[model samples]
Target chain A: MQAVEYFEVECPEALGGEYYKQIANDVLLDHNLLKVIDKLHIFIDPKVPVFVAVGLLKKISTRVRVGDFANVNPLEGKMTLVISDETYLASMLKIFWERFGKEKVEQPDRFTVILYNVPATPKEIEDIVVGDPSESLHKDLIYALRCIAPEGFRLRSEIFTGTKFTFVASENTLAEDIDTLVAEKFRLMGEVPP
Target chain B: MTLVPVTYKGGIFQHDIVVDLIEDLGGYIVQKHIIAQEVVLQCFVPREDIELIRQISRPLFGEVTDSPLVGTEIAIVSMSLEIHHLPHPSCDIAEYVRRLGAKSNMVSLARGPGKRIAGLNDEERDVINEHDIAVYLMGNFETCIEYKMPTLRRGIEVPIVLCGGPDKEVLERIIDPPVEGYVGNVGRFMRRTKEADELAKLDEIIDEITRVLEKKREEIAKDPLSVYPARLMGLIREQIPEILDVTSPTPLTVQIAGLRVKLPYDTFAERVKKVAIEDGITLGEVAEVLPSRMRDYVIVKVLPFSETNIAV
Candidate 1:
């Protein structure tokens, strides 16, 4: 029941309600945002020259680790890794090459990686972090928000959190009540403002 | 229904034959330009006789294609040529208009963004007025659209078609005195329009242009000029051999009322005015020859026979 895949974009009555929904959908898909975000609400008031976007990010529990992406088998002094997901293979190889030097790490096939000098415990490779999706999500969300905002709305104030992000942008001077307005928009979208 | 637009591209050697054939078919040449050894003529052939013009083009090593809006010019006006106003919906619409055979000019103004600074200057207005119809792409808010109408109303004299992202009702409510037409579903589109809805919107804009142009054509028929703009262009090219040396792709551009000769107004204005036509009549007698608004070039507005009191 908590997992409501709700995404809504609202424009001021002056700007025409639901007018920018397609544009919002386009910008979201263009940035490949459908994979990470579960709910999004965008509010635009052309009269105030303000654009606000609030999104709820789906939880990414752990970083991409070497053990999750590859199978490491140690035999003698060398170790072989048969990768399952190539998405983190480059990062995993970078870390392996850094520790064992370039000459020791060899990838002959797309999925097989061989290390000449294996450490005492081959399972130690399991704890190595390849990448974090949440970190990149923060970056990509801002990008998607930029594409949806008005062209003249250059000044932006973004509030980024672990699970949610709220961005407010405007061309003119930010009035003192901008925070209130953003909160009001979030409330309208059924979001408990942070 | 009277004139059907067509484009002919062929070699320069036998181009005159094609031109004569088009003339014999009761067709008029809107624009003629020589690109290297090749010549391209945009024409308005009689709708019923378009097939005859096509047949003549076949023997002349020419390619003839339908260009519906060839004889007319349209201006797509926006505040800036930057990422906001251009290369998106405006450029997309302009390209669409070009495909329909009308000459589309993208008019970008300096300081054209922000409600406080978005207004056209005299030079910009002159450039827009040169076109047959001006399409002003308004913004979202009705109040903003209303605020900007005065600048366009004061500067533009030709028919105007207001286009925006809002509904037709919203756009109509804001515009005063009623423009020639109002087209909705066109604005600052960041991406291309390939969807069914967006394509339908483009069709609507083209329909508005057709309606507005039809009205203007009827008005022109009521009080027709002594010479058509295309005919006047042909006369200028023949009488003034010096125009060939100008080297501009389009030394003379045909307009609704007259033509704009791309020559310095001071030196060439008098020569253009003195051009003698077949009737042993000077251009100055049937036209108001003066300097253009954008540049020093001459702007010739051929007067109606009722005004000049001489029927051609």
Candidate 2:
């Protein structure tokens, strides 16, 4: 496929523009294409420590939740969901069992499950779960991206869900000020700050 | 006389050089090739031959050059960028070079290891050849390094060392012009040495490269530079105002006695003359500022007309 877009950021002075360039070039030149897009969408977060470039991949989403990802419908006042793709099966099951209790959810098929007495609002059900599944989603996405990115990229990413979920990937050069770096990079790219 | 039956599994850029070094130091290449599968077996002769084999194979196997890419120590750049393991062949070679008191670069061809592997691009080839010396690690059992002769066989101006896992005879016979040298080892896929033992082998390789580098240093001593690069850097900083904006800390560094100014040659040549010492001697009057042989940086060398004719 043709490269539809290209983005780059001038790293902050703390990140050493030259040093960041070396790492960026190393990652860009070495990334694997079969699993992930080699080209990056980069922007400098001025709020970040100098010499760091925060990157985002637009239009590429690998998030899977119970109702958000698969078909969830009501039957006899209960929710019968058929998850064709069990991307977050473990987290989904954990959330389901914790909210509905282990006896309330039954799995007849490998990818299909039935939930009884589930709340009408999926958001309400999502909230009942003690731990946030979005964290794991972010981690999975980061792991996938790392497997796809070049070795030199040394990527560190954080995924979050509010109205919409965002996946942020960055080179791990800035150990302490990663959040600032990422925010600044997003601002530099004109992305709305979290 | 002593053949250590050294084996290297993967393919590298300077495999030929390693083979040549092994033979020159009195080691015979036992078996060599790119490792296609996960495992392979090799046999060794008497332990007495180990020294001769090691001496010959030492230069072939250990680190021999200072790697400009990774500044501190030698590290192997594996063929598959995904794999991260200890005793990384590229890192092993890099350490080998460092032990010899020279820098080493672990280079992986753009295409991963295989018989149909691609050669280095122009930029990559230039970087690989830029080293004072290079150790190319090739694949084990696979013929990618040899078959892709056009990639590595191009005339290398400096010593291009080579290493692989097959018998030395295979490398000698297959390589078109043949590499500078070759070393045998278990295939790249197979972990040859236990953690501690592998480190010991790496240390041995480093020792061999040090000896070679020492000899090279002696040869270079015949004619010393009138001025060292660091001295010129200080002089240029004091003399030139425009150099401050160049950005490189080690700006106006030297490669073989000539100064390499990080400033753009085309834009800065005329402006550089503004730099003058307290004695009113301008840089232009003492040295010729021109484009570098390799990059866009300005190359400066003292001309015979300079008051200080000898490099201080």
Q: If you superpose only chain B onto the true chain B, what TM-score does each candidate give?
A: 0.86, 0.50
DockQ for every model, please: 0.21, 0.03
Estimate, for each residue in B1-312, the C-alpha lDDT of model 1 and write its tens digit: 366668988989878999898888767887777899999889877788867766776777898887556767788887677655556678888888876767787887775655544567888888888778988876655655676677656868889999987778878887788898998757556678888988889888888987888798789889988877777787888988888899775688776667788888988888888888767888889999978776677888889978988655
lDDT of 1 by residue, A57-166 (tens): 88876788888988889888888889988988888888887887899899999999988876647767778888987777888888878767766577899998878789
Q: Which ten residues in a row have the lowest lDDT in candidate 1 chain A?
A: A11-20
Model 1 residue A172 distance off true place after TM-score fit, in angstroms: 4.4
For A1-194, candidate 2 gives per-residue lDDT tens digits of 24424345353332323333333443433442212332243443323212233344333444443556567666676777777666566677887777678988889888778887765564555334233443443444444444323233343455444322233433345466556755655665566555
Best by TM-score: 1
TM-score (C-alpha, index-matched) for candidate 2: 0.40
- What C-alpha lDDT, on a 0 to 100 scale, does residue A75 get in candidate 1? 80
By summed lDDT, which 10 consecutive residues of candidate 2 chain A come out lowest?
A44-53
Candidate 2 residue B294 C-alpha distance from true site, Å: 7.7
